[model samples]
Target: MNLVLTVLEITAPVFLLAAVGFTWVKLGFEYRVEFVTRLAMTLSVPCLIFVALMRTDIEPSALTTLTLAAITAYGVLTVLCFALVKLAKLDIRTFLAPLIMGNTGNLGLPVALFAFGDQGLGYAVVVFAIMGIYSFTFGIWIVSGGGSPTKAIKEPLVGATLLGALFLWQGWETPTFLTNAIELIGQMAIPMMLITLGVAVARLSPANLGRAVWLSVLRVGLCVAAATVVGLWFALPSVALAVLIVQVSTPVAVTSYLIAEKYGADSQDVAGLVVVSTLLSIVTIPLTLAFLV
Candidate 1:
């Protein structure tokens, strides 16, 4: 009834933007995913993160608590997913990172924004930042068997997170003109990410979909459970807890497939998980929001 419409109002625009990308690709339009992703990550996304963190009125202590909670939730997921991978006899390198690192950025941010507005976006950014740090460091190490920790430090998003956090801690604000400019750039991030997600999905060639289906189901279940436990244990406010649950439980990121391809670890299988899990998210995310809202 009213609840269903509310959820739809929140979710419809996200999938529709994605559908535009999917349909564009299907119609044989030219879309350079690599270039778009690089632009978003390096410029737009960093701007978004920096601006959001700088302007957020959320208490520093609350953010610190959520940070610890996100870390604990990921730790718990890592342990659980490792056991699950071992039991399923899947390639640990390929399956583990994707399972542990959900699509918190491309999918999670926008959903949070739609469902809970600016404050939700701010909270979601914290979770996304934590996920980004881990994915760049530990997630890469797992996939490639070797990676430099310094590389993660060099990432623009990481740098932005650090800078933004410092600004928040100091209660500093950028000049009005600069803040508005950065915000304009930041505003581009969500739509670009959503459309890029669709383009990536339209292009992925998933394999062994049956295996991917079950694995995706497991991933969703495990992420929601871990996030729930950690959020409640930390007593995160209602919106923060709900944001954490949704972000952690998002579908497998397309980057996992790209990393697998780069590192030579059954990219097709990872692609399968990405596609299946993302498609599965269309249903799972809204349902989760139905309750959270």
Candidate 2:
């Protein structure tokens, strides 16, 4: 009973903020998704990642373990999702990337912060960074049939992750005033991302929701299983293990839809994934958290 309430308390603000964006769009308001996304990705999210890594109190060894665990989990997920897509006779280009990558940034970060505190947020950031690099590189290639690996290196998120990792390793701190300013900007990232997630979902036009429902269920199951195996294999600490499961099991990201739309890989199918998977998370996240917490 206590655990149920704790899970709700952690997840409520995330969905509520997203709901605000969803409602705002339904009421016929203009929200430019591309602009908001650019702002968050280029500025706010980078700031958030950098500061979180720099200030994190988690041991450096723990961070490295989590990083390797995340990489292995995603690697396993890629192979598994590929096999599933082939077996289902789905369009591999359209379904593969979305299935493999979860919404680690907009959804995962905030949930980690609320559920596990600052240290958890720190661990979540590492997984998110790993996903960002993979999504920009391999995810793009899968969606577009060909993508430039160089583009991943050019992403602000990648730069931030590398820089942040360096700072963490060196035990360096930015000047007080600078850190405060960066922290303020970083603080905007969570709410902005949550609201943007709602706005994006509101605007998406889903198709084949029946298929999407089952696929989403499979996605959550496979992701949780893979993350659990990898976490145990790495012997991750309790908090890190919980964060790994939650982050990897997050719903399909809105970016998957955007990529499909841009690359002409059946945008409606991807949109179905984004909508169905996110709706499904309202149940799955709390249930998983109930166990983890």
Candidate 3:
């Protein structure tokens, strides 16, 4: 009963907001979803990440462990996808990004917060910060054939992460006013991202759903299973293990859609994967956590 309530408490708002966004679309709220997603990705989400990281104390010891875990988890996922892609003879340029990009920011971050509160949030943020840098740099190199590497390097959120770190490095306190403002904007990231997600979902057609569903299932199941076995062997903390597991288990990120759209991959396929995996994740994530607990 408690677990059921906990799942609902954590996830209900997400589904409800998605429904609201869908309804607003049906009701002719033109571009509602697009507007929200653009704002969230460009501003609110970065602010949230910056504030979270800045507010937390940097523990070098724990940082090493988290970094190792992230590298291991991501590295394993990449390898697994590569093997699968090759074995299945899938098109690498179009399908690889979607298959490999885990839902670190949206689903993973929230689950981390719920499972482990502030600590989990911080750890998850750091893992994703590292992942984002890699995704933009190495991911772009792989996807875009090395042109405009600078474009990949210059994400607003990267700037925000650096600013937050600079504050920490310089030992400067965040002014009360600035901190408060950042907090307010940061809080908007999660809900807005979800709504943007809904907009993305609303756009997907049934024709693409078949392939997307297969990819999503394969991505989630294989990646999470691999992470679970490794995490168990590492003797990571329960919360940390849970965090890593959930992060790896999440569907291909919505960013996969954007990247696919840019690089001429099947954007429809990517979006469908994102939407299906995210919805399916509500069940898979909590169950994975329950098992870990």
Instruction: Give the per-residue lDDT digits (tens) of candidate 2, residues 114-193.
Output: 99999999999999989988898899999997888888889898898889889999999999999999999999999999
By TM-score, the better pick of 1 and 3 is 1
For candidate 3, what is the lDDT? 0.72
Q: How far does residue 192 in candidate 1 sit from its true spot (Å)?
A: 0.5
lDDT of each: 0.93, 0.94, 0.72
TM-score of each: 0.99, 0.99, 0.88
The sequence of per-residue lDDT tens digits that candidate 1 reaches over residues 33-139 is 99999999999999999998899988888889999999999999999999999999988998999999899999999999999988898899999989988998899
The candidate that achieves the highest lDDT relative to the unseen native structure: 2
TM-score of 3: 0.88
lDDT of 2: 0.94
By lDDT, the better pick of 1 and 3 is 1
Error of 2 at 9 (Å): 0.8
RMSD, one per candidate, in order: 0.7, 0.7, 2.5
lDDT of 3 at 161: 70
Question: Could you tell me how far off, in angstroms, the CA of residue 255 lies in candidate 1 after the best superposition?
Answer: 0.5
